[model samples]
Target: MTTGSVNPRRADTRRNHERILIAAAESLAGSGEVSFNAIAKHAGVGVGTVYRHFPTPEALILAVYRREVRHLVEVVPALLAEHPPEQAFRVWTTDHLAHYMMTKRGLATALRSASATGGDLPANAYEAMVGAVATLLKANVEAGTVRAELEPETVLRGLGGLLYLDSADEWRKQAAALADLLWRGMCTHRD
Candidate 1:
């Protein structure tokens, strides 16, 4: 599909591009490895098409990661619409943690490279995540369901810590427990 100034490609090309992305995500998630040949095979497209579209492995990985991030970001608004703010916030936090854990292996190299270069992740991605958290948090606070002093960034950092811990299952459970604690701490209780 055309995006802004970019003209839409032929239907076949668009399909090929989408196939490549899907294959890339699967490959990356399953093996944490991405090969042009494999992606092309998975996409049922020729290697030439893969190269034409991505040119480099990093580019392909970036595309897959961005696509996943966009999906997660989009879910925020939908969650907010479908549930109470407190519940929505809790569910999104858990989902975000799961997403990060599932993709951590596949994204390690790219994340490291970005860190080494002192570069930020994609701008839209960063903003989208922050906006989602802020929106949820603000709604809860306004409703007297959460603390006014709660900082979205700090909460995110805590979630990250849980994901980064070495004991995966244990840490994930703790993260859930910690989330419960956070909710309790943030909520207003009137005697």
Candidate 2:
């Protein structure tokens, strides 16, 4: 029972937990709803497993929301390392940020509907998002791709349009256009 030792059962439990969260997030994004049965089936786990991991729809939704926000914050460093600063900023905005914004709207509605559990999602998402944007902005500034004075808060405000994107519509195109518009403003000089 040592904490440092890798227990196979614990590892399997972690895997199942991640799988359930991914499945639940996808379900909420695609359908704006949560079905434990469907999530269990999609995650390839028994329904009882899902129930054990998340006793209520509200708990599952909150966990999914937290996982997504964590991903958004965590992915920035990898994106910066993988691409040039400008490309990293663009890709993070158009890919991770956009998808998360769209999914977030769905999660909100689902949370409201799942009133029985009464679990409140955390309020620090704004600060987390601002931190992510700040990291991206700093990289771009260091690379001389954007103005050094550009504020992360302002840039994030500009991206607020993403939250309104209707997944049923041309959201990807709209997201790209919005990001492009913001990028132009953020750039120190046109390429």
Candidate 3:
């Protein structure tokens, strides 16, 4: 298949792949380990179809993680377009926290298991996150809302630390407070 060419069969395959990923993520987020049959059923596809796309559960898990990470990173531009730079940063940080929390423990364990088996998650996960932060920080700096000397990696590392907190209801509240604190430190004119 050539670049930019539209093949109906390939499009259909991509749709199925996306559906399976979404279903699997939802399953992993809501509860414990989900079987391939359950994922297939949730996706409205047969078991064979799921297997054809992802030969192993590890592959499926990793794919979902990568896709979600990409989505989070890609949303920075849109967020900035809709809100002020400081507001955009806060919104993105909150959204990022929510996404991480939604992925839940089961998906996390699968990622760790896959990494242990040398099917490691992509390093670009961190890079993508830092890049998004950098993009938002740059705009904020230009707008004079954030300090010019701030480092995107510093903010990213701090927020990354929050992702390790216990996944309890109180932790969610704390995470939001921590994000707000981080925003306060980053900004020049605090509200």
The prediction achieving the highest lDDT against the true structure is: 2
- lDDT: worst 10-residue window of model 3: 161-170
lDDT of 3 by residue, 53-146 (tens): 9998888889888888888888889999999987787777766646565674558888887778778788888888789889998999999988
Q: What value does the lDDT take at residue 44 in candidate 1?
A: 100
Candidate 2 vs 3: which has more TM-score? 2
Best by TM-score: 2
User: Please, what is the TM-score per model?
Assistant: 0.72, 0.90, 0.84
Query: Model 3: how far is 113 from its true place, Å?
Result: 1.0
lDDT of 3: 0.81
lDDT of 3 at 34: 58
Error (Å) of candidate 3 at residue 72 is 1.6
Tens-place lDDT per residue, model 2, 39-158, is 999999999999999998888998999999999999999999999998998889889988988788879887776654667666898899999999999998889889999889999999
Better lDDT candidate (2, 3): 2
